[model samples]
Target: MFTKILIANRGEIACRVARTARRLGIKTVAVYSTADAKAEHVKACDEAYWIGEAPAAESYLHGDKILAIAKLSGAQAIHPGYGFLSENAGFAESCKAAGVVFIGPPTQAIIAMGLKSESKRLMTEAKVPLVPGYHGADQAIDLLREQSQTIGYPQLIKASAGGGGKGMRVVKSFDEFDAALASAKREAISSFGNDAVLIERYLQKPRHVELQVFADTLGNVVHVFERDCSVQRRHQKVIEEAPAPQMTPELRHAMGQAAINAAKAIGYVGAGTVEFLLDQSGEFFFMEMNTRLQVEHPVTEMISGQDLVEWQLRVANGEPLPLTQEQLKINGHAFEARVYAETPERDFLPSTGRVSTLIAPETNDFVRIDTGIRQGDEVSMFYDPMIAKLIVWGQDRTQALQRLQEALSKYYIGGLNTNLEFLGNLARSADFAAGDVHTGFIEQHMAELFPEPSTPPDEVFAAALWCELDHTQARASKAQRQTLDPCSPWAIADAWRMNQASIDPFEFQVGEALYSIQGMQRNGTYYLKLATGEKPLSGERIQGDEWQIVLGQKTLRIKIIQSGNTWLVFWNNKVWHLNLHDPVHEADDQGVHGGGLTAPMAGTVLDVMVKVGDQVKAGDALMVMVAMKMEHTIAAPKEGIVQEIYFQVGDQVKDGDTLLSLE
Candidate 1:
C-alpha cells in the first residue's frame, strides 16, 4: 500500500478518498486551486498544495503541475478521483513516466475505453450487445445528418470524449437534428475540449442500469452487482438505487457477466463501471463504460458492504481481488439522491451562491452523506453544482425508500437554491414508490412533482420571525447551555418581547410578492398585520435554525437561515427565498430584465445575434450565454426593436446584469 498518495481532484470525491486513506493509515496530499484554498477537501487531508488558478484548465486539468505537486509532497501514488484527469490516458502515461503509481486502470485500458467510438468497436469484437448507431469518426455535418436518418428518429448525439449530459442531445425528428448537432458539439467542446460526436438510438424509456466491476493487476475480475440510475434530468442522473427494483436473478446474471466480459476485453484494472440501457422487454444494450469510479458508487458500497476506495488502493498495490464473485452477496437495498445547488423550477439551471447553512440528517447505520461542502462555502460557477450525495440503506427497497424520504426531510440548506424539496417529493411520489421509474421519470410526472413557485403564507410567516429575531443572543456555549432556559419567553416557548417595542411593519419579499407585516400588541395579545389581512401569531427560536412558530392554536417547527438581508425559510419540506424588499434596488433592477436583456447568471456571452435598431420577433434568439457548462439562450420576450447592446461575444456578465436593450 502507498504510504502517502496525492489526490488529483477536488470537492467530495477528494474528501471521500482522503477519508478511506486515513482509515487505512495512508497519508493523503490534496491538490487544490485558488478557489478551493479554504475548501473542505483541503482540510480533509494531511497536507494541501495549490496548483494554479480557479479555472480547471489553469489548475485541475494541468497534469504537469499536478505531477510536480505529487513529487513535492512525496506521494508514492496519485489517485485521480472520478473526474478531472481520472479518465485521461495521457495523464496515466505521464504518471507512469514520472515513476509514480496511478491508482486507476492501466494506460492501455484507458486508451481503449477513453473514446466512445473506439470503445464501442472494441466491445463489438468482444460480442457485447450494443445499440445500433453511427460510431464512425466522420465529423462532416452532412455525413452526420445522413447517418441520423439511417439510425432513425429518436436518436441521441453524444460527445465521444466525455459524458455528464454536457455534449449529449436528443433528436425527435429530422428538423431538430441540425440544431441539436451544433448545440451538442458546442457543449462538447466547452466541456471536454472535444467536438467529436457519435449518434445512437435514444432509448426513450430505458432503465440505466450499470454494474460495479473491479479488476486486479493479476487478471482477477468480479462484479459487485448493479445499480439502477434511471431517474434522470437533462441526460444526467438524479437518483440511483442498487439491486434494481424489478431485476430478476437471471437478468442480473446475464448483465453481470456481460459487464465482466466488457472489462476483461480492455484489460481493465481497478474500479470501473459498465453501463447498459435495459429496455422494457428485459433486453439490455451496452452503453459506454466509465473508466473511473461513478458518482453513484455509494449505492454499490452500501448493498455490497465493501469500501470501493480501499479496494481501488489494494488493486493498485497489486493485490488480488478481495473476494470471488460467488462470495460477494447483496446485503440490502440502497438509494442515493444527488442533492445539487440548482433550481428545479428554472429548468434545473445551476444556481451559484454561498452555502450559508448546511445540515444533514444524522448519519447512523441506515443513512450516509458524502460531501465536501462546508457552511459559508461558495457554490461558484467554476464547477459542478452538486452539493452532496445522500445515501440510505435498509433490508428491503421499501424500508430503504422510507428512510430516504425521512432523511431528505431532515436535510436543510440555506442562502441558496437547492433541490432538497424536489428530492423529497420524488421519494414520496407514488410512481417512484411503485417502482415505475425510467429516464423520463421526472418529466413524465412534472405537475405532481413540482409545486407552485409562489411561497405560501406559512413560509412568509417563518421569514417574518427569521428577520425579526436576533440569533447572536440565542447561541450559547456548551458550558453555558445548561444554564440557559429552554422555555424562556425571550428564547424558546412564547412570543419574544421586543427589546424596542413598536408598531413598525417589516417589509419582506417572498419570491416576487412583497409583504408588509406589522407586529401589534393588542389587548395583551399579539397579532400580525399583513397585506392580505391580520393574524394572531407568535414564535421563538427553539433550536439552531429551527423556530417554534405559533399560529393561533397550532405550533410548528420552521427552519430559518438568515444571512445578511437574505433569509431562507424551510417549511413543509420546501425552501422559500425571502429578502427585505428594497424599492430602491427594485427600481434599479427593473431595467435589468424589463428594458435591457439581462444575464440570468454569471457567464460569458457566447453569441450576439442582434444589434441596435434591429427588428426581432418574440422568442427569437438574441444572445447565448454559457456558464458552469450550462448553456442558456436569451430570447426576445416580446416583438420589439433592439435599442441598445451592452455586451459583446466573449464578455463576462454578472447575475442580473443587463446585456441588451429592447423597445
Candidate 2:
C-alpha cells in the first residue's frame, strides 16, 4: 500500500477518506482553501496544506496546484473524494504523467462515460438497455426541434456534461421547446463549459436505482448490490436506502449483471456507480454512469460491510479484487438521510452561519453519523451545505427505518435554519413509512410535509422564562462571590420577595409576533399567566444545561442554552429559539417599497431576464442568481413594467440588495 495519499476535496468526504487511510496505517494529507483554514477536515489529517482562496476555481478545482502540493508533501497517490476534480479526465491523466497514482477510474474510462451523448452511444454498442432518445452530435436548433417531435411530447433536454440537476429542463409541449432549449444550453455552458445536449423520453413516476460496481487492474469486476435513490427534491437525492424495499431477487440479479457489464465495457477500474430508471412496468433503462464515488455510498457500505474508500486505495496500488461477486452478500437493510443546513418552508433555500451549538444523536453498532462539522463550525456559502449523513442499519427495512426516525429527532443544530423538522416529518409520514417513494415524492406530499404551524403550548413559554431566570441568578452569584458577601440581594431570583405577591411582566418575540407573559411569586410558589391561560409551574436545575420542570401534574426534562439575546429551548424532540424583548430598545423598520425586488441571499447575478420598460406578469422570471453552486430565479411579485435594473450579469450582490424595481 502507498505510505501517504493526498485528499483532493473538502468537507465530510475528505474526513471520511482520511479515516480509512488511517485505519490501514497510511498517512493522509489534506488540502484546504482560505475559508477552510480551521475546517474539521484539516484537523483530521496527519498533515495539511493551504492551496488558494475560498473560491473552488482558485483552490479545490485547480488541478495543477493540487498536483504541486502532492509532490511537495511526498504523497504517493491522490484521492478525489466524489466532487470538484474527482471526475476530471484531464486531471487523472496529469496525475499519471507525474508518477502519482490517481485513485479512480483510468483516464480513458472517464472520457468514455463523461459526456452524455458519447456515453449513450457507447452503451448502445455494448447492448445495454437504453431509453429512446436522440444522442446525435448535431447542435442546430431546428434539428433538435425535429428530434423532439420524433421523441414525442413531454421530453427531457439534458446537458451532455451535467450533474446535480444543473443544465436540465423538462418540456411538456412543442410551444415551450425553443425557450427551454435556449435556457438549458446557456446554463450548460456556464456550469460545465459544454453547451451540447441530448433529448430523451421523460418517464412518469420512475424509481431511481443504481448498482455499485468495482473493478481492478487485473481486469476483474464485481457488483455490490444496489441503492434506491428515489426520494428526491429539485432532481437531487434526499433519502437513500440499500436493497430496495420492493426489489425482487430476479430483478436484482439482472440489474447487477447489467451494471457490471457496463463497467467492463469501458475497461473501468476502481469505484463507480451505474444508474438506472426503473419504470412502473418492471422495466429499467440506463440513465448514466458516475465515474467516481457517489454521495450516498454509505448506504451501500452499511449493507455490504465493505469500505469503498479502502477498496479504491487497494485497487490504485495494483491489488486484485478483495472479494469476488459470489462472496459478497447483503447482511441487513440500511437507510441514509442527508441532513442539510436549509429551510424547507422557503423552498429549501440554503443557509449559512456559524453553528452556535450542535449535538448529534448517540451512535452505536446500528446508528452512524458521517460528518465533518462540530460546534462552532461555520457553514459557508462557498460549497455544498450538507451538514451530515445519518445512516442506520437493522435486521429488516422496518426496523432500520424506525431507527432512522429516532436518530433524526435527536439531531440538533442552532444559529441557522435547517430542515431537521422537515426530514423528521417525512421519515414519520405514512406514505414514506410504507415505501411509496419516487422522484416526485416531495411534490406529491407537500401539504403533509409542510403542515401549518401549531400554536406552542403554555409549557414551552414557561420553560423559556425559567431559563432566563436561571441565567440571571448564575450571573448574580458570580458577582456576589467576588464581593465577599454571602447575603447579597443580587443573588436572589428577580421579583422574589418575602412580602406580598409580585408580578413581573416579561415580553418575548418569536418571528413577527410579540408575546406577553407575567411571572408571579407568592409564598415560595410560582404561577405563570399568559393570554391563553394560567398554569402553576416549578423548575429546578438538574446538573448542567438541563432542567426539570413541573406544570400541574406533568413533569418534563428540557435542555436550554442561552447565546447572546436568543434562548434556545429543546423539548419533545423539537427546538425553538425565542428572543427576549427589551423595552429599552426598539427595532427601526424602513417603509416597504411595493415595487422593489431584492436578492434573498449573497450570490452573483447570472442573467437579467428582464430589461427596463419590459412588461411582465406576476410569477415571471426576472433574473437568475447563482449561490453556493446552485441557481435560483427571482420572479416578479405582481404584473408591472420594469422601471430599473440595478445589477447585471457577473455582478456580486449581498443579501437583501435590491436587484431591480418595477412600476
Per-residue lDDT of model 2, residues 1-663, tens digit only: 999999999999999999999999999999999999999999999999999999898999999999999999999999999879998999999999999999999999999888999999889888889989999989998999999999997889998987777788889999999989988888888778899999999988889999999999999999899999999876778989998979999999999998988998899999999999999999999999999999999989999999999999999999999999999999889999998887888777777888987878889989988899888999887788898999999899999998998888778788787888888888888988888888888999999999876555677788888777767768877776777556777554467556656877778777666788988876677888887677788899897777898876779988776767977677654666678998678776532376898887677899998899999999999999887777788999899999999999999887678999999
How many residue pairs in model 2 have overlapping backbones? 0
Point out the worst 10-residue segment of candidate 1 by lDDT.
471-480
lDDT of 1 by residue, 148-213 (tens): 999998999999989878788999999999889988998888888889999999886899999999
TM-scores for every predicted model: 0.88, 0.94
lDDT of 2 at 272: 96
Could you tell me how far off, in angstroms, the CA of residue 410 lies in candidate 2 after the best superposition?
2.0
Off by over 4 Å in 1: 453-509, 514-571, 575-595, 609-615, 640-643
Q: Model 1 compared with the native: what TM-score?
A: 0.88
Q: What's model 2's overall lDDT?
A: 0.88
Q: Candidate 2 clashing pairs?
A: none
